[model samples]
Structures are given as C-alpha cells and as structure tokens.
Target chain A: MRSFIKLASVALAGLFSAQSWALNIFACEPEWGSLAKELAPEATIYSATTAYQDPHYIEARPSLVAKARKADMLVCTGAEMEVGWLPVLLRQAGNPRIQADQPGHLMAAEQVERLEVLQKVTRSMGDVHAGGNPHVHLDPHRLLQIAEVLRDRLMVVDAENSHHYRQRFVDFAARWALAIEQWEQQAAPLKGLQYVAYHKNFSYFAEWLGLQRLATLEPKPGVPPSAKHVQKLHNLLEGQSVLAVLTTAAQPTKNAERLARKLNSPAVVLPFSPGAEGAEDLYSLFQISIDRLLAAR
Target chain B: MKNISVWMAASAAVAFSSVADAQNRGRISSTEFNPAISLILDAGLAIYDNDEDYEIAGFPLGGEAGVAEEGFAINEIELVGSADVDDKFYGKITLGIHQDEGETELDIEEAFFQTTALPHGFTVKGGKFFSELGYLNVHHKHAWDFADAPLVYRALLGRQFNDTGLQARWIAPTETFLEVGAEWARGDAFPTGGSPQDGRGSAVLFAHIGGDIGASNSWQLGVSHLQADDVVTELGGHSHGGGDAPDNEFLGDVTISGVDFVYKWAPNGNAKQRNLKIQAEYFVREMDGEFEFEDAANAESGDGNIVADQTGWYVQAVYQFVPRWRVGLRYDQLDSDNQFSNVSFTGFGSADDLIEESGWADEDVKPARSTIMFDYSNSEFSRLRLQYSTEDSRHPGEEKDQQIFLQYVYSLGSHGAHRF
Candidate 1:
C-alpha cells in the first residue's frame, strides 16, 4: 500500500509538470509576439498592442493586466518604447516572475546596439528616447541578435524545453538568413533613394537599404506636423529628386498625402510592424515594406 | 619602481578605453537613479455674470469645493514625485499649491506606497491616497476632461474623497476584466469629519468590471459603497451670540453609495487622431443623526432628531473630432429630502429657521447646471481650453449665472503614464 501511494504522488507531480511545460508569453507589441512565436511555436502568446496601434502610448487595460498576471515570460522592445503603460501594467500585474532583472523578463532592444542615441536629452527634444531609437526590429541584423538573446532567455526560464527551443532557433536562424540575403539583393535598387517620411519611424529601415531621408513631416519626434513645418520641409526639398513620401499604417495618411501632393510623388503606406496589411509575419513585414518602396519608385 | 610604472600605464589604458566606450554608447554623464519629478501648472481666467456667494441649495460645501475665482488666477500648481522604493514597493507623493482669498495655500494631496510583488493578483497600498470610490475620483484634476469637478462630486463627495488610508485590491482571473477593492481610512476630511469610531472613521468597498468591445471600443462599470460612523458637522455653531440664536451641531452616521460607467471609442484602437469618451456617475447619501442646539443668550438648550437623504448625478461626453482638438458637454443635477422630529424650542428661533440654516431642508427645487467646453493641445505636455457654463444651482430659480473660462495647463519634467 505504501508503494502504491508513492506511485500515485509521482503521477500527480508529472501531471502538474506537464501542464507547466507550455509557456505563456505576454508581448508588449505584435512584433515581439511574432518573434516569440517563431522561437517557441508551442507557447501561447498574447500581444498587448496590435500593428495598427502605436506602441509608445497604450491604455493599461484590465485584460492586459490579467494576461500579465498569468504570463510565464514577458517580451518587449524596451528602451522606453513602452514606458507609458508597461510600468503601470507590471505594477498592477503583481507577478514577480516577469519583473525587471528576472530571467523571464526579456527586453529585446537592450540586447542590440541602438542607433540615434542622444548625447543630451530634455523635454525640448520632443519625446526622444534617451536609450536611442526603439525601432531596432527594422534592421534584420539587429533583429537576429535580439533573437539570439531571446532564445537564451527562453532556455534559461524553461530549461526542460531547452533542446526544443535550440532546435527551433537553429532552423529559424537559417531560414531568416536566407531570406535576408534575398531581400538585400531585391532592395539593392533602393540604395541612395531619396525619400520623405511622416515620422522618424523608418530610420533603421532607411539605414539598412542605404536610403537617403531628405526630411520628415513632423518637425520633431512625437510632435504632430503643423502647416508651417510642412511648408518648410517642402521648401527644403522642392528642387531635389525625391523618391516618395512614406508613412506607416498606424500613422495618419492625410499629412503624408498632402506632402506627397506638394512634392508630386506617390505616397507609400508601409506595413511598419507585423499584423498590418500584407505583413502577417516578420518575413512578410520586411517583404511588404520593400515591395511598397520599390512600387513607389 | 619599473613594475609599478608598467601597472599604472596598463590601468590608465583600461580607464581611457572605457571612457571612450561610454561616449560611443552615448551614456549620459549625469544619469542617476533618481525619482522622477514633474510639476504641473494650471492657470485660468474666468468671468461670471452673477458673482454672489456660490452655494448649492441643499448641500453644505466642505474640503476644496468652491467656484473658480473671477478674472485671472492661479488655479493649481502641483509637484509630483514617484519612484520604486525598492524591489518590493513603489512610492509617490503629490503636493498641491494654489491661491485662495489672496493667500497661497499648500496641501499634501497624496502620499502613498503600494506593494509590487504580492502574489495571487493582490496588491496592498498604505498611506494617504484618493479613495477609489467612483470612476472619476481616482484621477487627478489635470487628467479630468473638464476644467472643474462635476456638480455631483462637489455636492456629495466634497469635490473628492481623499484621506489617510490603507487599501487592498484583487483582480480576478477572468477572460474579461474584474477588480475588487476595499479601503479603511482615518476619515479626517470633509463628508466625514472628526475621525470618529476610535479613529477608524470610514470603510469602503468597490468593484469594477470592464472589457473591450471589439477593436475600437472599451467600457467599464463600477459600484462602490462607503460607510462612516460618528460624522460631526457644525451647522450654525459660532462663538459670537445673538438674541434668539442657537449654536447647533450635528452628529450622525453617514452612508454613501455610487455607481459609475464609462465608455470609450477610438478608430481601430488608435486614439492619436480621434476618440470619444462618455462617462456618468450617480450617488446617493443618507445621514441619520441628531441636532444639538444651545441658546446661550436665552439660557436654553434643546435637541432634535433629523434624517436626510440626498442624491446627485452628472453625465458628460468628450469627443476628439480631430487630432489635438476636443469638444465636451456635461449636465448635472441634485436633489435632497430632510425630515425633522421631536424638536421643542423656546426663544431660539423657529425650527424652520434651524433646518434652513443646516442646508438640509428640501426646497422642492432640483439644482442643475449645463456646461460646454472646447480644448486644444499642442502636444501631450500643454493644453489650452475655453469653457462656458450656465448654472442655476446656487440660487435655484433666482437667476442663472452665465460663466466663461479660459484655462491653460502645462507640465514640466518627467510625467507618469495616465491610467485608463
């Protein structure tokens, strides 16, 4: 009878461990959610903000709090990209597993070398991120580095699935590398293509393709464009050979179109993040963005 | 000596390289783990046709409930600081500065610490903080859609209910949103003065449930109740005495219950361009107590039992039709009923006069007001607003006051995220 009782206890423990094997991931944005899915396809993923929404400002909704409460891992593009709401949501979640410095907490931006890092920051900078630009995902090389960090973190948090995670990472990395090579070849024509954008959202993308940014519609980061600022930008780029006026799906297209009309160029709406139109995954997101730029040319 | 020199050169090389690396990384030399500090400045110019003393017909105002001063005035300047105290707790303090009657007044609006590492979706908060009794009470004044508190809040909650308190809240693990919380306060503020019941004066329970309606809409509904024992109010108490005048005091138990609802909509869940928010709250208060009167000049004293019931409500909607621009409309109404019993007086004036002075007698007129406002925000840090309101609550049928206000609010330094 004693042996039977011990066996029953062992069986119960196995059941509990099996239930915990499937990770619950809470991502601050759809891009991270998509990347996490690639690394751990078996994990359940929930994205707090969709591609159509701005990641900088979002409401700390109760549903998000509930998700954070149950998450086994929290993945986000940190560097104050989610400074507005993630802190509040973390405090409200009350889950120590995903707090800062915990193994389950992963900030993708911190793992990469950022661009546009400021020497001095003040409110007059118009919402500039002191840690640098948080839109590092647009650069596929930095994204690969972030993925390596994410895989290592996932293995540390869920050691039992380390082998499975490693295998998935290897396959994903190979495929991603091949895709990047093809994209670079296809986007070679975009090199030195002068363009205008609504915001500084495409800084990494432009850098990756060697695109020249003539000016932005917004005078400063996070500040809406005024007629005077637009007029100034138009004057600055009036005689230059501008490729196109660019905007993201999340930003208002009116200003971009107005500027495009003034410049006599096509207004291209790029899928800035995953889950946007024609950009259902990381691979498609870049493909669609490049296709849109080339189409404008 | 040669070895020492070689070691010093190696150390110098390492230090110089590290400094260069730091500069390449753009690390701020002045960066420190300091608490974030923000200051909000609010100033406004107001014009009112009727400048008589502002008062709700059946509600005695207390705390910071009053009309905005006429002409240009500094409305409120608030300094706020917040930080994570450590791994386990977060703390925040807010100091409010304003001008009152040609004098500057300072108030510690909120100081609180909340636990961050509690399990089972439970959080405990201690210190002086605003009571989460209603939807709008927890939000600071600068976050309000309108320039002033709603008439219901002014009449029933004395503008807002904030005091020294401890709170505990739990979020249920549901598909939708469900939250339950309770508070225990010292209750030394208005609506419950004197810190009765052995200094544990007030207790409150609140529950909220919310969910998103598709991708573009969200809504929240809440219910709350507050009970306070031994609330004391000085009705006509004064040191100077007049013939046939009585010094009256009220002592009683008070209970207030409220329900609030809020609905918000933004196109495709993006609020940067356009959004609409509609919110409403209704509150009912009941006071059961006795009025103790002392007629010092007539050398007589008497006691009377009084029961009062009051209700107030306001509904407002603000629509952001374009980026950085918004328009709003609000309506407020209030009602009260009072019953007096077992009063015998001699040479201390009539009971009618005492009841009227208490501001509890029903005058068969419901106080109401209508307001409209338009605001423009250059950015998230600065806002300018123009408001117009018609109020009949102060005099209630005597004359309605047409009021206009132009206000500006600006924030400097680091500001925390606003809660939904």
Candidate 2:
C-alpha cells in the first residue's frame, strides 16, 4: 500500500510540471499574437482583436474577460492606444498577474521610440494619442527592438523556457534583418513618392520608405470624412502628380476609391496587419504591403 | 559677400525658432495630477398636448419619476470625477444638479470605491452606487438612447434604483461569460423607506450569462431579485394636484423579481459603421402594507389593510443605420392588482373614497406608452436628439398626452469609458 501511494504522488508531480510549461498568452492585437507564436511555439495564444476589427474601439466582451482571467501574460500596443476598452477588461478579469506594472504585462510600443508625440493635446484635435502614434509595429527596426524585449519578458514570466525563447529571438532577428534589407532595396525606386491615405496608420511605414503623404482623407484624427472636406481635398490636389490613394483593408474603401477616381490614380488597399488577405503572418504582411505599393506605382 | 550675409541671417532665424519650439515641448501644468473630471449638460424643449396633472392610476410614484416640464428647460447637469485611489482600489463620485419648482437642487448621484486586485475573479465594491437590478438601471441618464425613462421604469422603480450599499461579484472561469453578484443597501431611497432593519433595509441577488454568437452578434441574459422589510412610504398628496386629498402613509414589506435580456449585432464586431441593439426587462413586485390617512381640518380619518401585486415591462430597439446617426423605438406597460380589507372612514368619505384617494383604485386601465426617437452624434462628446411619445396612463376620462422633446447633451473634459 505504501508503494502504491508513492506511485500516485509521482504521477501528480509529473502532471504539475507538465502544466507549468504550457503558458497562456493574451495579445490585444493580432500582430503581437503572431510575434508571441514565433517566440513560444508551445504556448497557447489568444488575440482579442482581429485584423478586421479596430483596436481603438473594441468592446470588452465576456469572452475577452474570460481569456484575460486565465492569461499568464498580456501583450499589447499600449500608449493609450487601447484606452477605450482594455481598462474595463483588466478590471473585470481580477487577475493580479497581468495588471499594469507587473512582469506579465508587456506593452510593445513602450519598448521603442514612438513617432508623432503631441506637444499639446485637447479634444479639438480629435482623438489624437497623447503619448504618440502606437502603430510602432510597422517599422521593422522598432519591431525588432520590441521582439528582443518580449523575449526577455517571456523569460521572466516563464523561466523554464528561457533557452528556447532566447534561441527563437536570435533566429527571428536574423531573418527579419535579411528581409528588411531586401525590402529596402526593392523599395529604393519609390523614394519621395507622393500619396494620400485614409488615416495616419502608415506613418511609420511611410517614414521608413521615404514616401511623402500629401494629406489624409479624414478632416481630423478619428473623425469620418465629410463631403465638403472630400471635395476640398479634391480641389487642392486636382492636377498634382499624385502616386496613389492608399488605404487598409479594415477601412471603408468608398471615400478612398472616390478620391482616387477623381485624381486619376489607383486606390491601393494594403494588408494592415496579420490575418488580412495575403498577410497570414508577419513576414507576408510586410511583403504584401510593399508588393501592392510597387504594383500600384 | 552680400549673398553670404543674407544666408547667415536666414539660418540664424531658423535656429532661434527651433530653440523656441523645443522650449514649448513639455510644459508642466498645474492640474496634471488632478483626477479625471467631466461635466455633462442636458437641456431640452418639451411640448405636451395635455396640461393636466400626470398620474398613473393605481400606482403611486416616488423619487424623480414624473413628466417633463412644459417648454424649454435645463433637465439636469452632472459633474463626475473618477480616479484610481491606489494600487488596491478605485473611487468615483458624481453630483447631479436639476431645477425643482423654480429652485435649484443638488444630489449626490453616486460615490463608491471598487477593489482592483481582488483574487480568484472576485471584486468588492463599497459606498453609494446604483444597484445592478436590471440592465438599464446601472447606466446614467446621459448614456440612455432616449431622452426620457421608460414608463415601466418610472412606475415601478421610480425611474431608477440607487442607494448607499456594498456589493460583491464573482466571475466564473468559463469559456462564455457568467457572473453572479449580490448587494446590501441602506435603502433610504424610494421603493424602500427609512433604512429599516438596522440599516440593512434591502438585499439584492443577481446572475448573468452571456456570449458571442459568431463575429456579428452577442447577447446577455440576467435574473435579479430584491427584498426589503419594514418599509414606510407616503403616497399621493401634493402630486395629484388635488388640494382636498389627504396624504396617505404606508407601512409594509416589499419583494421584487425581474428578468432582463439584451442582444447586439454589429457586422464583424465593428460598431462604428453600423449596429443594432435590442433589450427588454420584466419585473413583478408584491407589497403587503397598511394605509392610513387623516384630514385634520374636517376631522375625517381612514385606515385599511392592503395587499398589491404590480407588474411592468419595457422593450426597446435602437439601430445605428449610418455613421453618427441612430434611430430607436420603445414600448412599455404597467399593471397592478390591489386588495383592501378592514376599511373604515369617518365624516367626509367612504371605503371607496379612501381607496380612490390612496391611488390604489383598480380602474381596469393598464398604463402604457410608445416612444420613438432619432439622434445624431457629432462626436463621442456631443449629441442632439428629437423624440416623440404618446402615453395613456391618466384617468379614464383624460385624453392621451402627446409629447415632443428636442434635447441636446454635451460633455466637456475627461470622461471614463462606458461599460456594456
């Protein structure tokens, strides 16, 4: 009987050890979910918002609260980018591990330099992010920096998989650098190309590629374009040498298409993040964006 | 030499301006550490066809449950402040200001602290707050889709139920959403009177379950129960606008049970462009009490033992068919059954007169109303709405009241995110 009891204790210990290695990660957006997948292949991941959904205006659905309650770590693009709903979810989840300032809370935008930081902020400026533009994932250099920090975070949260996370980081960094080099060379001819976009969603991308954005479709940040505003823009750029009107798949295409038709240019729709059309992963996301731009030019 | 001197002047001007810009980058402001504060202003122009006293037969109203004043007026102004007190707790306070009979009145709408780091999916809240009795009761008036309260809410809950209380909630660890919560309140508010039972006048229990139906739809269903003891209430003296009627005092116990359901649909979980929301709630209440009235001038008096059963319901649908524009429709109704015995009266009235004066006479009229509204939001902070409603809850001989309201709500300063 004693030998049987010892055998039972051994089995229980084995089960506990196996469970510790399987971490649960909750990513606020699909881009971070993809990155987490690359780092910890064995862990379970859940992305709260998909590519088609706007991260800024998502609801704190019950399913999201459940996911957050069980999450071992949370990865988000924070600088108040998710100010609308993330706070409610965190408070409802009642999980101390993923609260702000904890080891399990990782905000990717905070790990790198941010662009478009405002000097003065007010509601008159529309829904401007005070900290900066939180779309830092579009810049390949900033993404690499965030990846390194995420790897370290993962190590701290799950120390048993430190070696695995480190090795994956080295591999991802090397491959990403090579892809950045190739993209730069391919995009060299597109320097100083003037364009118009739906929003400031592509600021980091345009800065990295030396593209000039003449204006945006929105009259102000987060405000939908009015007919008067659209007509005014048309009159301003009627006969100028504009390359194309660029927009994301998530944005409505009617305004962009109308403006593009008026300007006699193509309305190019790019995959804004992972899980979009032809953007199944991070690599394909950048590849498809550059490819679409080159094709449009 | 002349061209070189001009170039040097342009460079110097540019450098000086750049330095000035740098100096303006991060100025420290005096209100940096202040809590997030916001002010909401609600004003409206109301036109009604009937200029008589508003009363629903067989149901006495309490709290701020009444028809809007005729003509243009400021309905309410709400000042709210909220912030995290520390790592362990969050606190918020709201003050409501409104006009009352040519006088300005102020009331504390809510003041509460909620725990932030409670373990095992449990959270505790203390102080004064809105009771989670139904779906719409927890929301403020500014967040409502329409300008006025539903008829059922006005008749049964006195527009809404709130009190000084402590609440605890637990979220289950399930794939779908499930939550159970309970509240204990001082119950000095309407529907429960005088903080009875040693300051534990009322207790409430509620449970909710919800989930997403694919990417385009989501739903929630809830059930709640509330019970109060030793309630002492007054009904129908000055509110009836009849100078001869004496005030009736009620001593009783009350029990209320309700069920609420809500369904929302947005294409691909994106509500910015288009969405539809439908919600409904049904409640039943039982009151066992004694009613007494005395006419001092005539030395007339009355006393009776009474038992009443009341039911009310409202169903509403709001559709956002385009960006920044929405339209809604709501229908609500109320019914009551009253039984009186051991009735006696002196000098000026009979048992029937006592019953009629108490506003508990069963006239075979079920109060009901239908309302429709259209609104436009310029941004998240400002909205303008136009609403029309027709109600027939008055005495049998009175004509139905037709009402039209043009309302505007504007918010200033920082505001917290809305809860679903």
Over the stretch B81-126, how does candidate 1's per-residue lDDT look in tens digits? Answer: 9988888888999999999768999999999999987877789999
Per-model chain B TM-scores are: 0.87, 0.90
DockQ each candidate and list the results.
0.29, 0.22
The best candidate in terms of TM-score: 2
Give the distance in Å from residue A246's predicted Cα in candidate 1 to where it truly belongs. 1.0
How accurate locally, in lDDT, is each candidate? 0.82, 0.83
Which residue pairs of candidate 2 clash?
Answer: none
- Quality of candidate 2's docking, in CAPRI categories? incorrect
Fnat across every predicted model, in order = 0.36, 0.35
Distance from true location, Cα of A265 in model 2, Å: 1.2
TM-score of chain B of 2: 0.90
In the range B1-420, model 2's lDDT, one tens digit per residue, is 113344345324532333233235322221254677989999999999988777887787777778777799999999998877787887889999999668999999999999887877888989888888888888899989999988877877878889898999998878888989999999777777778888888999998888888888988899998899888765653245445546566789888899999998888887888989999999998889887777536576688898989999999999999889999999989899988999888864578876776677758789999999999998888999999999988768889989999999999887667767
